[model samples]
Target chain A: MLDQAFEALKTYDWGTDVAVLAPIDEAVVATSGDSASREQLERRLAAVLAEDVSRDAKDYVCRKLMAIGTAASVPALAALLPSAELSHMARFALERIPAPEAGQALREALASVAGSQKVGVVTSLAGRGENESVAALARLVGDGDPAVARAAVIGLGRIRTPEAARALESAKPADPQAKLEAIDARLACAEALLAAGKKAEALAVYKPLAGPQQPKHVRLGATRGMLAASGKKAD
Target chain B: MGGQHQPTRRRFLQTAGAAAAAPYVITSAALGQGAIPPASERIVMGGIGIGNQGQWDQEAFLGRPDVQYVALCDVRQSVREKYKAKVDERYQNRDCQTYNDYRELLAREDIDAVHVATPDHWHAIQVVEACRQGKDVYCQKPETRTLREGPLLIEAARRFARVVSGGSQRVLEDYTELVNKCWSGELGPIKWINVNVGPLSQLCNLPAEETPADIDWDLWLGPAPWAPYNALRCSGSFATTGGSWRSYVDYSGGGMTDWGAHHFGGATFAVDVREKQPVEIEYIADPQGDHLAFHYDNGVILYHNRPKTENLAVEGTPGQQREAKPVPVYKGEGGIYGDFIHCVKTRERPFRDIELAVNTIAVSHLGTIAYNLRRSLKWDAAAQTFTGDEEANRYLDRARREPWVL
Candidate 1:
């Protein structure tokens, strides 16, 4: 039944009856306890991604990989990262693969993809909280594209390490909108730092943003962050 | 600071008093015309996702004399126009604005609060963004789509000091009888409770259809994976079966979360464990059937779909009675809606505060993961992770599709 499902998958496209793929779903549930079976299923599903299947078929495989894919499946998913039609789903799996190789695949794609695709890769790296991508994300914080630069800014905010915070502080996005996003991201980084008990680091970020030159809301957030970090409450 | 800032009524009054020597004209509109409260006294509001429940929420807010509904947002052009027309009609003018994007509406400096009734996938993002924008939120349940989203939602609300109310009236009203019985202490020392809610969401492969011009399909599928535009795949119907987004894994947790939000919310509140998440989930597969026993730190267990146990069933020691305590109820005049508006005005926590709401949904999400893995698991609530189970831990959250981050 699994083999039949795989065969059917090669021709699967949007609008097709999804019931033909029920055997794959059953296999996902059935092999939960059987490591050998689960690994075999993962390999088979990964192989389908490299096949001449419709985008829908590969999407199905990626969804399954998201559940059970291992390091061995990372290469196949990574191969699709440069394809705009397939990059999002590929990251969808790679982002949650629990394997370092998956994060590396996304980082490598940073140099290979562009526009919204690159933005997607940046987001996945941030979503995984991959400390390794901090430098690459920092470099993109002032990218020519406002969307990419803004995504990189928010990505660093999510990364939230002291290094990421520093990168955010130094980022100089030429776009007005990106500059605003930088402030929001900086405040977010401070909150994250404060939550992690890095009081001094959090205060360093907050104190600067809380200055009179900042917007009322930005100053408000920074003030609140400073109060919380200093074990005080805002009245 | 870059945009125009609208001072609150209190701030306005303070400034006005300080400038008493200056000549100023107070129009009837500023003092509030006829039946409506003054502009300074009313809560300026906006509605996101004005579909079935969104419309109902809007109507409730419109009915409040203290609320000034000013904006409506929906991805569907038809829905946006229809609701905007309705709001304009209610105000006897064309003052209400409409937007296809929620971000644009959230950018308005004059809007004080928003009620978000978007699909489950958009809930956390919208709520968190609203918090960042300094707007109080009344978000519809289930408050989160994943276990990881629960904490982020709560953190955003707390970090911004925003009043966020969960949109589950059933948690208090529908289960009042059971809640009263438990709080009354008639059945002393409750040991366990059963909440039978089931049939997890499934994968969707609905065939491609012509994308309707009325809706921005990509925005509708925000954060979720790209699927072809099919009416049934995005239907807002109550069904957890194949017809609606509720039935799809990408958009919802099926009935396990859709109705689970209400059922488990009621069950946990009834059992007085509304503030806690189960520390462990034991998946049992007997010859009779498969069920789950969720163990709380306090020795209370929440059973999910245990065979022969009815929904919201509580097992307690009958002979020994415990001390009765006053049941918690909504604070303001109206039900959940009024409670939220009142809290927004008073800076108090609403009845279904975001933290409690997140905890209620956590039960459903944990149970769903347990069933998906088909095994028992230990949850470290503080860490919000599975104990030593990497495979199970991977399910904590999924990678959201491009351009959307929480």
Candidate 2:
């Protein structure tokens, strides 16, 4: 039944009988009962992505994969990451799939893909909170493409770890615009620390940026963050 | 700190020095983000339903140093012109765009967010679409006119990952103090809650009137059941506080939803209800009486009517309890506008998130049905249905006019 629905997805239009895809839902639910069923469901969807078909079919399959895909499915989805057209849908599945290999696939793509596709892959890794890619992102933080560097900073912000902050604090961008995002990620790291009740750690992230030698704007933000961390209202 | 990507000191100094002279120095960076512009770069915004409350909101957004009103929209051309001229003169730019259709303003990718002060019936659709477009939304109080619309709007925000702050500004510390106090459990099992927002409305029966030229009557009735134009029922005046639409079941649920959005939006934050709906409701339709009451599974009951306190309060078995003093909004930042703007930059949840706002409004819609039937209704909160009451369940959503989709 799930295979029939997968075949039907190739020609499914927006207003098609929504029930025709009920098998896809049943397969997704069926996976939750055990790891074997989950692997089978994920493999079925991953196989669909490797087929020659419309982008819509891949998107439909990715939607199912988001709920059930695993490490076994990452390689098939990863192969599509170099395709500008299919990478987004691939990332959509990869972003929600909880597997270290999925993160590694995204990290490997950083040194390979270029332009917005690379930026988007960086964003996907960021969305996954991939701490292993911090060094790679720190390198991309210096990418010639300002948009990609900016995307890398946003990626670092989502990571919310001491290492991500260390890289963000040190890396300088060619684009003045990207520096603002680097500063933003630094603060995000502080905020996450503060939220976890690590006031001292949060203050460490704020104090240097709040220093008199820092840029006035950065100083102002860091000062506010420092005060807020120390139990004073800055807003 | 870098191999080849370091920006020159001269470039950094130029941008930083330029920012020193911009208006409202460092106002939006409380979250450490918005833009890197010299003090002057503004968050672009659009105002929909610029009549009374909408006009006031338009002015509020314009008043910020960090916000630029690129467009203004209202269903009535007269009101649109009135507010557009005000915005144009204030910005000293005559090119401020005006639109009769909100979808037009929403189409502009330059807009960072929208202030949706449309009528209650139009609130859910506009906010949902705006969020779906990746634009942050500030929707007015009584965020939804029906229960079914609530989940869809919430789903849109969730799927799009956009900020949606309900415009019930009164849920601030002025009201939260009491709810926060009660949630601490010092109130001792809160025997009863008197919300007292005022009365509920039944069917609207205003006499029909000729449609005015400046107003687009059909657009105003979007998604709502068809009704002939009536001056008292469908005018710019209805956008003001205590307007005719508030008394119409088709357009609104009267004061029941109006103050319920304010009181109930903050009630959960105060009380220990956490996040859940009332399991039952009883509605009575006397103009001067307690119009409705909702029963929670926790055995705490809430009543609606005009109350004496300026803020939300509750009754214990022995006495009344509230905060020693209120958490006052800082002088310049005193309303939902500041909170919404802050959330836009920080991506933190606003004071009144619309999903929670809808949860409160759904209770009021339950009240509206109870009043219409004049009977007690048992509700299954999980299923979102009435037990064996088909007629009552039908009131969860209304029939739409042709071509107007939910």
Best by DockQ: 1
DockQ of each: 0.55, 0.02
Please give the TM-score that candidate 1 achieves against the real structure. 0.94
Off by over 4 Å in 2: A1-235, B1-41, B173-177, B180-186, B236-243, B266-269, B282-292, B305-313, B317-334
- Model 1 lDDT per residue over B299-346, tens place: 999999889888988988899887898999998888999999999999
Candidate 1's C-alpha runs over 4 A off are A172-181, A212-220, A233-235, B1-30, B33-35
**What's each prediction's clash count?**
1, 3
C-alpha root-mean-square deviation, candidate 2: 14.5
True-structure lDDT of candidate 2: 0.69
Please, what are the lDDT tens digits per residue for candidate 1 over residues A119-184? 899989988898899999999977887788888998897788888999997787765445656776
For model 1, report DockQ.
Answer: 0.55
Q: Please give, as one word, the docking class of candidate 1.
A: medium
* Best candidate (score: TM-score): 1
lDDT (0-100) at residue B270 of candidate 1? Answer: 90
Report the Cα lDDT for residue B372, model 1. 86
